[model samples]
Target chain A: MAHLGLRRFPPPLMVLLFLATAAGKEEYGGGSGGLRFRREGGTFKVLQVADMHFGDGRSTPCEDVLPAQQRGCSDLNTTAFLYRVLRAEDPDLVVFTGDNIYGADSSDAAKSMDAAIAPAIAMKLPWAAVLGNHDQEGTLSRESVMRHLVGMKNSLSGLNPEGIKIDGYGNYNLEVGGVEGTLLANKSVLNLYFLDSGDYSTVWWIPGYGWIKASQQAWFRQTSSDLQKRYTTEEPTQKEPAPGLVYFHIPVPEFGSFTASSFTGVKQEGISSPSINSGFFTTMLESGDVKAAFIGHDHINDFCGKLSGIQLCYDGGFGYHAYGKAGWSWRARVVSVQLEKAESGEWRGVKSIKTWKRLDDQHLTTIDSEVLWNRGSNEPQPI
Target chain B: MAHLGLRRFPPPLMVLLFLATAAGKEEYGGGSGGLRFRREGGTFKVLQVADMHFGDGRSTPCEDVLPAQQRGCSDLNTTAFLYRVLRAEDPDLVVFTGDNIYGADSSDAAKSMDAAIAPAIAMKLPWAAVLGNHDQEGTLSRESVMRHLVGMKNSLSGLNPEGIKIDGYGNYNLEVGGVEGTLLANKSVLNLYFLDSGDYSTVWWIPGYGWIKASQQAWFRQTSSDLQKRYTTEEPTQKEPAPGLVYFHIPVPEFGSFTASSFTGVKQEGISSPSINSGFFTTMLESGDVKAAFIGHDHINDFCGKLSGIQLCYDGGFGYHAYGKAGWSWRARVVSVQLEKAESGEWRGVKSIKTWKRLDDQHLTTIDSEVLWNRGSNEPQPI
Candidate 1:
């Protein structure tokens, strides 16, 4: 059997093996570290496929396929969508925001999951995922799914053996290293927090949604504060803490907090309902580390609005098995952040970040292009 | 034509008329003021009939009536339910937490509203209300509904000429004074904030739920702070700021911010979906005045739990026309706050608060009785 976890191979050997094999992959930012960004100043592109909801080849019908198609089942549709997006955007990293596989029978889940992620695996592209509410609804538990995902080649999922041991799974952070002259030894230029928002409620008698528990909140606060303290030191390039983005399956309650007038894109469906107010959003807002949050449960709703200062956005539907209106077109959100040099001859952090959606039909047309965050040219230097 | 408002009547004359005609009524706390409380230390009972959904007598059918009944419609059922509760509980105050009148037709909404409130009016009982999401679904807007409610015989609704004008309606506060011995003028022993969680979204497309706007949140914070400052003055009986309870139709986003294990009641269905986090709950937590909040929108799902420190509760279902399970026994929540003499021989603020639900089956039985808040004997006096 293939290795089920990163621990099977030692860290140094794994790093050496990854670097040796990653030479031909254009998507891989070839470096000594596990996951690295551009050493020279350039833009880091990320394509997010949210709410894939893929199923076994026979069980789930492909909702987005043409009438004449025969093998338009969930697995086929997911593969085609991923292949299309990969060929079109060629992102440095691909992030799957939960619901990647429709939980069918446990026996077929491994093959189904493999087929769902086959495009990325075949392309030798780096990818990561957080389990969604529906990912564990079938036979396989979330831990089992994590094992499968972590075992895949070029998978960047940091599912620690002893993560949040409560009800959820895969509560880990991934870091992208700064340039060589970025001044900080132990600091990263950007951080990505992936949280498991958990499935249905187990404590309450009535089966409904659950919130991020107190333990997770505590973990988040400690980790976030640690990151902020580590990066906010008086280093020349690090005047402020590095900006981060949070991704999870179910959108936080604050996702519903903004006005529609403030939104820049189409508000198709209203926000999908959330069961409770997990203080995760409040924690991020107070920590000031998270500049934006991207969520995927509400497939039809794709609008980004600023709530209190952080941007809350929805990645438009990317799955064919999920429910959505016809002709609405399945799309994926592409986010790119660029690095620049400051006037003081120091490498500054991400200069600007922009986001847009690419149509997944015959024509790969980009729509709703908007600048989510910009480190202005006239921004003052640290005193 | 009948009077649409009380502005036509002189204030002093109306007061005199109310005082003259308000005799022999058990519900009227007959003192010099408009609505008075018990003089000696005792419990003040409040029966909340939430989500009445009273229609214009014909358009909406009463869903809970017996099969043999002929007048099985919304208006009749609402009136009967109110009359039954009033005759059974004889509560000190009847608080209708929105959705009182289902606006079937704009022209007949006035009569429908009048019929809905006739039971309390005939009993000369003091009452108040907040608008719900469905209250103004027809031609009559929330402003018109508030106007009609304010003009009623014994109404205590504080809807002003110019309220929260941006999105919602009737952002006002009601006061429950302490025993006559408590010191301070223009001060209250307990405050009840009634907010209009507005109807549908005029901003977002697809016609889903809307959130409490920023302006309303600001209003709540300012009003709560002012009340806290006013009540925290150096009075012999008032050692601490007075306690408060907030009532609205749609719950704040923090209502979803709790775990099921943290909940204490029967988790029939999880908390009804809240669209957005308006930061109202955070404001209440920070201001340290609001002890609990009661809401009534999802008719069948009624559960109460502590999010942070504040208690978030539901009033259960009281309307027969609304959608709920068959023969599930519609109910209303009764909240009572008790005042007790402190060591200083002065009447202290609310000593203990209890809640119970009354079922509307063949017999009236109170169930799920729990003490939500209490000033324990060993508790230190507020200095």
Candidate 2:
């Protein structure tokens, strides 16, 4: 399944932990480095792994499985699936869209967090994540969990934006740039946003999942505006805003907009969105910068559907420690490309973007491929 | 139960209604005049009648009643209850907080609308309303229902804030001024906001009860800010925003934040709020002008509790056509006094606000009276 020849590292070599540089990433609170297009095709592939729910390694038993498969099955099986997918796809970046660890099942949240992202760390692929509803349930506070994630090797997660007050930790943005040292080297062609959807309802009256607060919405609006300003300022002729891909744990209420027939993949369960419609969808629509938002909370829902021009998708539950449909193979949604527009047709902004999913089966079954957006004449569907 | 001597108009005279002046108020789209505190004690008493669920006269039968009481129990019983409460309380202003008529049951919405508000119209008391989920179910759309209400005699409801783009109709505000002809005759002593908490979810995905949208919240915030600016401009020494009393149909999600012990009255049914939060409560909290919010969707809930700082209360099941407990009496919540602050000794701005409830039984039972807010040192509770 691995296509790229020299660039795609072999699974044997990828699994071995690559020693990190002696230079400290201690002050790297995300967005300082490590996000660029592939040298061969200029493709920036993003693999979204949701709800890993990793726990005490082999001690944790996989839930909702057949009696025969449950013998020695544990969180290690989840790790195996992750490595399998990574080996097959060899993505540029991996985004863990929440519920990275089942905090309730772990005695040490730091270890669980580390173990959950170990596959990405070992592969030395830059990864960013947003904490979900169950992520703060273990021995760590939400702040501690986020801090642990921010310090991990090859991690690009931050403890909220630099000076602003956003609700939960890990609310930050990563700028995926064009090729290094060229005219578009420092310029961001694509932006990836990671926002924590929160642990639980802290508001006594609103008993359920905690929602993205008004403050978070305000922060998003400001960030969106700031990004558009910088993008337009640099290239005055290209007034369009840079395309964005947002990652969060919980789905906004708008996720329920799709019917089974209208969407691409399956919706095995209800979308466990917050009871409160915090108006983030409206903000996104107004911003006109975000192209798609990927989330994970409802484990069985793996569909991708466009609502009011923006795509809302899910990463079908990835961890064996978490409850899943018996025979359903855990899967990952892969965004294959974000083409960088080059000067004078040599190939500079985002040119085209596409996405699909890959199952954890032996063949690494690919399905539900679709074009999210295109700047050229090759757009498959009407946006 | 009647407190004032000569100022309290007799029930019989009140019902006669001095035939509305030939000078047609056909053009009165609210805020053209008429909202002033009574001269006797300078108190602005407001009667909240919720969920009248009126239908085509005597043919409509009541629901959830004992076998004996079921015999001649129809919407007329609800009408009788309204009249009984009105006669006993003799309120200065009446506000119908949604579900004024069961649109599904009514063959003629206009006739039903007239019948539902007949008590207030007949008594010639100034009345305003915010439609509920059931108001547009039968013969007309939400706009038609509100248009009819705005045209009714003695009705103060408007078809939304002037020239604004609020979601539903009947989104408007009323200003209760100081006694006529005085130096403070034009000053707004109290601000009453009447917003239509829509009939159903128009945003396809978020299905349930209709919610107050971001647009409406923005309208409310702007109106609040404008009111504050005017108040401060008029009285530079008084930096405080005008005390606001908001009236709507469905409660915001915050209504569920209270326990039985924390609030007064009974919550017999689940809080029938919209699934989406919409952040109206947060906007109100930030505005600092709203002293209390009165809503009516959940028929059996008559509880009044404070969440954060704002008071959220229900008007009980006032309509026979709607569902209710067999033993519980139909009732109305009353805001008895909005004390006008005096310059030297006599009254001027809103100094204190108090609320209570009255049943439709033979004694016209009054219950759960408390001080909502008081500017003077006389405030009972901490908030």
Expressed as tens digits, the lDDT of each residue in A1-383 for candidate 2 is 11011112343432231111112212211123557776567788999999999888899999887788889999999999999999888998899998999999998999998888999999988888889888888999888888888888878777766554446787877776665533444456678777877777654445577777655665666667666776676432255677888999998988998888888899999888766556677656555678888999888999998875678888889999998998888889999765655555432667777888888777989998988777644222222
Strongest candidate by TM-score: 2
Candidate 2 ranges beyond 4 A from true positions = A1-32, A235-237, A340-345, A376-383, B1-383
- DockQ result, candidate 1: 0.02
State the lDDT of candidate 1 residue by residue for A179-276, as single tens digits.
54343222456777777877765533223565555345545555666666656642333666677778877877777766768887777776654454
What range of 10 consecutive residues in model 1 chain B has the weakest lDDT sum?
Answer: B1-10
Interface RMSD for each candidate model? Answer: 15.4, 8.3
* Among all candidates shown, the one with the greatest DockQ: 2
The CA lDDT at B19 in model 1 is 48
- Our model 2 lands, by Cα RMSD against the true structure, at 15.9
Off by over 4 Å in 1: A1-33, A64-74, A105-107, A160-167, A181-186, A205-207, A234-237, A344-346, A376-383, B1-383
